[model samples]
Target: MKVGIIGIGHMGQAIIDGLLNTMKSEELILSNHRINDAMTTYQEEHQIEVVTDNQSVINANPDFVIFTTPAPVTLAVMQEFKTLSAQTVILSAAAGISLAEINAILPEQPVALLMPNTPVAVNHGTLGVALNEYITDSEPIESFLQQLGDVFITSEREFGIFGTVTGCGPAFVDVFMAALGDAAVKNGLNRELAYQAAASMVKGSASLMQETNIAPDVLKDQVTTPGGSTIRGVVALEQHAFRAAVIDAVEASNG
Candidate 1:
């Protein structure tokens, strides 16, 4: 299938990386408003065609066109292709844009909103997908998305919250991990080892949660014996309003 990508930014590049393993490079066409060294480097490394303008991408008449540009840019690009054939499926990775908004600009077009995190670069990220009524067969797109990570089909109303948790959660986890490393450093571990230990612990904890299908509180209780150091640390976190802070962070991201 002929696929066109409209930008080469971080998310755009990640999508390209994920697709290359599944789709033929020659069947893909990429175009950017401003082609930078990174885009040029990627083009040369992958030996894929990189056109100079959006019109070239539209002219290609690809079956699938992914708009990886910013929200404002996506709107502008849709306007530029307002007369695009209804047969093409339009997917956007812009966060604030909604399916209704896209349909307003291009009615009857198959529009889907995809929210993916940076970890998609490593093929283990979370993706939130919301398809419009115009999309009759989502299997092809969903199958391709599954190659990058777990894809959750949701309503447009739920897509933003999904992004808040999976997309913004990475930064929150990084901050918590940094604090863990700092505490280990205070306890005499070297900086590198401290970070490694903190990261590994979090990774294992997440895997354990998935494998055991246990609630976080239950897992916490399992790890904390009476008067144990773990319970003491948990008490300190509770005293500091850790849970409330994390909750507020997710809410803030949603806003």
Candidate 2:
């Protein structure tokens, strides 16, 4: 199947990279509003076709057209392409844009809203997908999305919360890693070594949680034996309300 993506920004490029790395499509068409020099460099480096005009993307006659532009631009582009009959499925990766809003714009077409995080570039992304009432149990789309990453089908209302977690979670984890690395650096460890250790520990901890299927509290108990160093660290974290702060940050992002 042919797939066309509009607005080849960071997220759009990430999705295109995921698709090209996984699926063998008949054709992949990409377009951006600016078509700057950097885009030309990317096209040459990746051997992907780039279109300067928005209408060119619609003219590609893709089975699926993914709108990765910002919300305002996405609405405008959808309005422009509303007359195109060749585009069957409309997928929007824009945050804050609801499936209902998309349906209202294209009333006759099938629309799906997706929230895909940056980790899609590494094939480990967490994606939340919500389909309009027109789409029911589409196995092909599911199979296609699975190639990009782990896919979760959810209601539109839940999409914002899930998006905050999966979409914004990577940066949050990175912040924690950076803080750990900074602490290690203050202890006289080389910055590179500190970062390497911090990153590896985080990865291992995540893997343990995934493989064991145990609650994080149970795992913390296993490490925080009586009068241990881990217990001391936990006590400090509790004193500082670390968990509460993280929760508040997540909640604030959704708001």
Candidate 3:
């Protein structure tokens, strides 16, 4: 199936990277408001068609037309494509745009909302998807989404929290790792090695938690001896209100 993409921002690029493995280069068409050096390089490297105008993307007869424009620009882009056939499915990845808003403008068209993180570049992303009434069978879309990573079907209301946990969680984890890496450097470890080790530890710990189905607290307790350094570090985090800070971060993202 032909798929057209409008906008090539970070999320858009990540999605393109994931789709390239599942779809043929000739089946993909991309467009941006203005082509930059990066866009030119991406087009050359991927060998995908990059059209000059939005209309040309739709003219390509794509089954799926994905809009990865900024939230503020999403509605305008949809309005511009108002004449598109109802047979085409529209997918939006803008952060704050909702299905109701999309349907209000293009009432006959099927629309899908997706919030995917940057890790889609590595094909290990988490995507939160919400479909409108027009979409009857999700298997086709779900199959494509699975290629990116895990898929969580959720309501628009829950998408905010999903965005917080999966979309923004990576940055939070990076911040935590940077802190640990800083401490490691202070203790005489090479800065690059410290960062690499910290990332590996976090990745392995998360994998372990998922594979073993162990509660985080249980795992933490198992690793912490009565008077051990692990317990001391845990206590220090508690004293500094680390848990509360993370909760606040999620809440802030939701708002």
Q: Which wins on TM-score, candidate 1 or candidate 3? A: 3
Candidate 2 residue pairs in clash (backbone atoms < 3 Å): none
lDDT of all the models against the reference?
Answer: 0.86, 0.84, 0.88
Off by over 4 Å in 3: none
Per-residue alpha-carbon lDDT of model 3 for 80-195, expressed as tens digits?
88888788888899988889999999996889998899888778899988999999988888887787888888887787788789999999999999999999999999999999
lDDT of 1 by residue, 1-255 (tens): 788888788888888888787789887888888767877788899888788777776777888888888887788778887767778888899879888888999989998998988777778779989999998878987887787878989898888899899999999999998998898899899999999988899889988998899998999999899999999999999999999999999989889
Instruction: Point out the worst 10-residue segment of candidate 2 by lDDT.
Output: 80-89
RMSD of each: 2.1, 2.0, 1.7
The candidate scoring highest on lDDT is 3
Q: Look at candidate 1 and tell me the lDDT of residue 167.
A: 91
For residues 124-239, write the lDDT of model 2, one tens digit per residue: 78888888888876676778778788899888888889999988889899999999999999999999999999989987988899899999999999999899999999999999
TM per model?
Answer: 0.90, 0.91, 0.93
**Per-prediction count of colliding residue pairs?**
0, 0, 0
